[model samples]
Target: MKKYRITVNGKTYEVEVEEITAPAPAPKKETPSVSTIEAPKAKAEPAPTPAATPKKATPAGKLTINAPMPGTILSIKAKPGSAVKKGQVIMILEAMKMENEILAPQDGKILSIEVTEGSSVNTGDILAVME
Candidate 1:
């Protein structure tokens, strides 16, 4: 047994550990002849069909804001058809336990919000569109 002191989260504690030894290997049994064994036939499975995904129609020459990293949408600050200025915060995203502000790319009216609060998003997922 070994004694040691450990500190975690600003707390200290003393503990002891016992050393364990590996067990001896067991004796091997004789193998059966291959000629006496029978293999089962395998059945082929059909391929799965892909699910249909709804597409969002983006207007021409509009700016689309995408998520910077994988995260959950914490809250939305701007609404559709609302006017926003360049560098304005439009939404908040929670990623890695941190709250990140989603900002507007340029001055424009928000055409649509692609994601809602509490929605999980991946990197490059569309968040909103403006024009």
Candidate 2:
């Protein structure tokens, strides 16, 4: 048996508890927890204003390629400083039980690769950048 004193939110409480912790009763095996909180439903916060969208880069400028759909990145076929051709396969993305080849949007050098193999990505996740 033990006694405990707790303070939270500028309030104090004294509690007495018995410590006869044997194998927890079957179908009620969860450890008992002590709290001074009142459970309540969560309230959603207001959405924030969206920032302005950046202009998409052209072949002469750095172009970022985002995931066309949500999926795991199976492989990144190119790295930074690698030359790529228009419509060249730059990455392989796996989504919905399919392995889809990602093609370069334009002829350019790979400027950056944003995701690694086996990493999960969502639609619009920046996958690579070319310039």
Candidate 3:
């Protein structure tokens, strides 16, 4: 075993590590609370990952309403393919201990409701599309 001392912010600690020979492969373990996300497969093979450069996202619709800040979706007041009026409440986004109504910015059919109640969203995340 080898011992080493570490100091951080005026604190010190000792650690020991031992060398092992011919180590066996460790068993793979899965946690009960961990979920494995599988991506869509193409023709029985794994899809290739995208390039390092982020693809420019297609510009969202002109009349789409986006999240104002990071928050939880407290409620959804509209559905997909429904007609909505300008300034109508589409969802209640909760942030900073207050519920902010996410309203529509234009009169159009609700192309999609991107989030459901209890969803966590961030600033500039698309919440709904109108077209």
Candidate 4:
């Protein structure tokens, strides 16, 4: 076992790790002959149709806010049609156990929010649109 101290976000944590060793190989066992049994055939089924989900339309010539990293949305601080200032926190995203603030790029009115709380998003994924 090995012990180590780690620091993250100005916090320190002590942890212990256990090392594992490979075990010896097991002896081979005899298998049943293929000719002894006959397998039944399976019938193919059609794939189920997905439910329709309504999508919000984005206006043209609007600024889009995108996620900077892959994470789950923790909370939304602003709503659609709300006015926001530059550098204002619009939402919070939880990534790698860290809460990252999603800020507005510029002063504008939010046209729409693309993601809800608890939704997962990846880098470059659109989070909202503003005018």
**TM-score, each model?**
0.58, 0.55, 0.54, 0.56
Say what the RMSD of model 1 is.
Answer: 9.9
Instruction: Give one digit per residue, the lDDT tens place, for model 1 in 1-131.
Output: 99999999999999999988989788779876666667887788888886644556667898889899999999999999999999999999999999999999999999999999999998878899999
List RMSD in Å for every model shown. Answer: 9.9, 17.9, 15.5, 8.9
The positional error of residue 41 in candidate 4, measured at the CA in angstroms, is 42
Q: Per-residue lDDT tens digits of candidate 2, residues 21-99?
A: 5897568668899889888988999989876545445446568899999999998899899999999999999999999
Q: Which candidate number would show the highest lDDT if scored against the true structure?
A: 1
Q: Alpha-carbon error at 68 in model 1, in Å?
A: 0.6
Ordering by lDDT:
1, 4, 2, 3
lDDT of 4 by residue, 1-131 (tens): 99999999999999999988989799769776676566788788888986654444556789889899999999999999999999999999999999999999999999889999999987778899999
lDDT of 3 at 109: 85
lDDT of 3 at 74: 94
| Alpha-carbon lDDT, every model | 0.92, 0.87, 0.83, 0.91
After superposition, candidate 3 runs with Cα above 4 Å error: 1-62
Error of 2 at 8 (Å): 68
Model 3: pairs clashing at backbone N, Cα or C within 3 Å: none
What would you estimate as the lDDT of candidate 2? Answer: 0.87
Predicted model with the maximum TM-score: 1
* Pairs that clash in candidate 2: none
Better of 1 and 4 by TM-score: 1
